[model samples]
Target: MLDWLIIGGGIHGTHAALRLTAQAGVAADRVRLLDPQPSLLARWTQCTGNVQMPFLRSPVVHHIGLSAFELFEFSRTPEGKRFAAFAPPYDRPAYALFQAHCHHLLTQHRLPELHIQSKAVGLHRMGERGWRVETPAGGLDARRVVLALGLSDQPAYPAWTAALASSGAPVRHVFDPNFRAAELGDWQQAVVFGGGISAAQLALALAARQPGTVTLLLPHPLRIHQFDSDPGWLGPKYMRAFEAERSLDRRRRMIREARHRGSVPKDVAQNLRLAAQRRELRLCEAQVLDAQPTDAHRIQLHLSPGDSLETDCLLLATGFDGRRPGGAWLDAAVATYELPIAPCGYPVVSRALRWARGLYVMGPLAELELGPTARNIAGARKAADRLAQVAERRRTGHQVTAA
Candidate 1:
């Protein structure tokens, strides 16, 4: 029996595991973190590749530290800082520095307690106040659980993708495991889809890789704005306003407006334009109406304007569709004995983040309580604080229970 079982050992899992260890009064040996990957952030290798990301969109103060200045203080030391110092009063650290800091923190903490290299099979309530998690290795009894799954792995392909696949040449989404940028042999022309930072970065990556060029297809009439939402969304200025909203629909609308996921930065846009001007790339506002595979394995893209574009490949970079708790795993694991979920698909919880007897939700699922930033790195701290407060009360025999 384990004291805690944290699923998906990404950044959220890392922090939550540490906090859980502290709260449960258990050593690392007693805690278990189940992740499909051998190392943390295995999914983020592409986004943080040797790319020169000027500064993080997030603030420097918001970090995985006991104190806000912990990362800053660590930045002054040798292994502490990887990127150069931020020139003057800027509060944002270079993205490189942030990645480096994360590396240092994970290594320093020797995290990933009881790392399970297999995937989660499912989850179900065990006894009166515990959970029995099913995995490739079999069942493990846990006193608490946390979900840290991210959005990147689950790419949202438009329904037309399959219809397009029926075409002579099939289009592939960027998130496909078999999609390799290096082996794009003899394929000069390609169509890249989506309008988020991922799409922009992938376009830049693809453009950099080939002597040939790629076209970025967008739905919007104009190139989306960089840093589209206010940085203040991270702080209380906009967050409090969002929190004060009484209706979930109203709040979700705010999320839709503020979640500027696919916007490219100015530098990336410059690269795309330079590639275009040099005849290495083309940027267009045409949407992908349909897709199909040709006899020679090339993709045939049918545009909205009654025009057809044939390319060696079509990479859909569209982001994830709606995701909350409860999918196949939840369906398989959650028995009829657990607390009821809200209509929106997330576990209905108190302000402390607990869903049932010993089950808690930490990452994106916390949106109902933490608002729009629930999936961001900063939200980890807020979750930690809330869970920690409850842990303290429980330590003193408070016996916090589900509503």
Candidate 2:
């Protein structure tokens, strides 16, 4: 039996494994991280590359490392010197440099050896407080389990998307595994639906790749924000207010109101503006009511307030639905264990991020406990810090300092 079995080898899982061995004094051989991808952050790499994102929206301090200052200190090193600044005020790190820093952490920590490239199909309690994780290869018993499953892999489809499918139109979500940006070759016109950073990035990519016009259909006008949510959420400034809300439903409402939803960075918005000025992009503030496939390999989009658009291809840059993270796996696990889930479909984890028994969770599922930053890289570190403390206390029977 393993000491710890972390599900989902993305940023959260990888960082949790590192914390368990390094800070919590757990044996390296006793911890295992399970993911479907052949390598760590494979889906993240593919999704970022698909839209050709130049820089990360998050700051340099947010990374898969113990110290927040590690990346900043690394910026002064020879290997990290290749990094370039994004813009003023925010000064986001270049995506390549960020990735290089991650590779360095993996090598420094020897994280690759801890990875198990398999999907966790089922999770159930075993003897006493232990867990039995089921996979296609076999079952692995573990003393504890940490669900680090990030929800980025699950692509969400709008209600109108079903009509498009019924009409036999060629439509694809940007996060679909089989949808390749390169496969959109020789298209004369394309339409993108979304108003977030991914939508902005994909529209720019389409404009650059396709020969003809590209239109971006958004339900609301573009709102530019430095980060996904207010920087205040990163600290106790907004978090204190968030914690004061006693009701979970009220907390959910606070999270929604705090987030600058469907917004993009200033740089991304500028790029889209430049593309529009060049006559290669069209920005439409309209809702897609329905869609049907027309003859000649085109799709007819029925917009709100008596508007319509015809395009050769339609792409949904919309992201995944948070209410249902990994769909079946999470549903089955929640149902089997009778986990305490909020009405909004998120887990109501303990202060130490424990879900039930020996099972713990981080990332989006821990939002109610960790606040708005729960899904970002920074939240992974915070969750790791808390979890490491728990593991250390369990191991040494003494008070442990924060990592």
Candidate 3:
């Protein structure tokens, strides 16, 4: 039996394992991280693969290492010196630098084996001691379980997606991992949806491949405006303001306003304009109403400037569902043992993010505990750190003699 069973081995699960073994004094062998991927950080390929972004929206302190400055300290070492310029604490760090810093730490750790290519089917609780996790490999008895699932589990296709899918169309939200962007061929026109940073990056990426062949569709007017995440909410100031509101309705409204609903930062905004100026990209304001297949080879999209359009392909950068992943794991687990699910389909977690019977949650699901940013990388660290402390306490309290 492992001391901790952390599901999802991306940044969240990795942090949980690292903090538990290295910092919290839990034996390394006692920690088990189970993820379906063959390696870590694979999900970022779809999200951040286009242009190498400089300047992370988050600061250096918000990273994967155990200590707050562990990333900074590692950056100065030989493996990390290449990224030292981006490590200046006072300045906003670069994405490439941050990514490199994280990779460097992963290398230093010599890649701990926490089981790869494993998907957790769900979980069941032992009578009192721990939880039982079902994996493709077999069953794992863990003293504590941490749900560190990432954004991939909850890809939020637009509402119209279901209608289109039911209509038996080639249409699909870009979040489908099977839909390979590189597989696209010579097409005269394609539409990339959304107005946020992702929309811009995808438009730029597609245009560079096909050249003057793609258009961007946004539901609203372009602002040439800069919208990084809210700075006030980074710490306690603005966060507490949202927290103080007792009503979930008010809290939801405040969260919406606090996050970037559909906007890009200054740098990304400029990059999109540059991509357009190169005559490879075009941006338009229009809403997508319905999409259906004209044939196996073509799709007709009904648009709501009150018109229609045809496209070779469509990409939806809309984001993910706050609800559970479209998988059997959540529903199966809930049904198997009767777990309490919030009306939103998210697990109602304690302030420490434990679900029921000592099973905990992290990442996007932990948003209610840590606030709106809980889906981001920094929030991953926070979730892992907190869960580690809880797991540590439980493990120490339960050591049994061979007698």
TM-score for all models, in order of appearance: 0.85, 0.93, 0.85
Candidate that would win on TM-score: 2
User: Which lDDT tens digits does candidate 1 get at residues 51-163?
Assistant: 22456655677666556777688788887555746522346677667778777777766774467777777787877768888888898788777776666566688877765
Cα lDDT of model 2 overall? 0.83
Candidate 2 TM-score, true structure as reference: 0.93
Which pairs clash in the backbone of model 2? Answer: none
* Global lDDT scores for all candidate models: 0.68, 0.83, 0.71
Candidate 2 lDDT over 338-380, as tens digits, reads 9888889888877789888788889888889888888888889
Model 3 lDDT, residue 131, Cα: 89
The residue-by-residue lDDT of candidate 3 on 236-325, one tens digit each, is 888777666665556556665667767776666777778888887887788888877787656787888677777867678777665665
Clashing pairs in 3: 55-94, 156-320
Error of model 1, residue 344, in angstroms: 2.4
Worst 10 residues of 3 by lDDT: 394-403
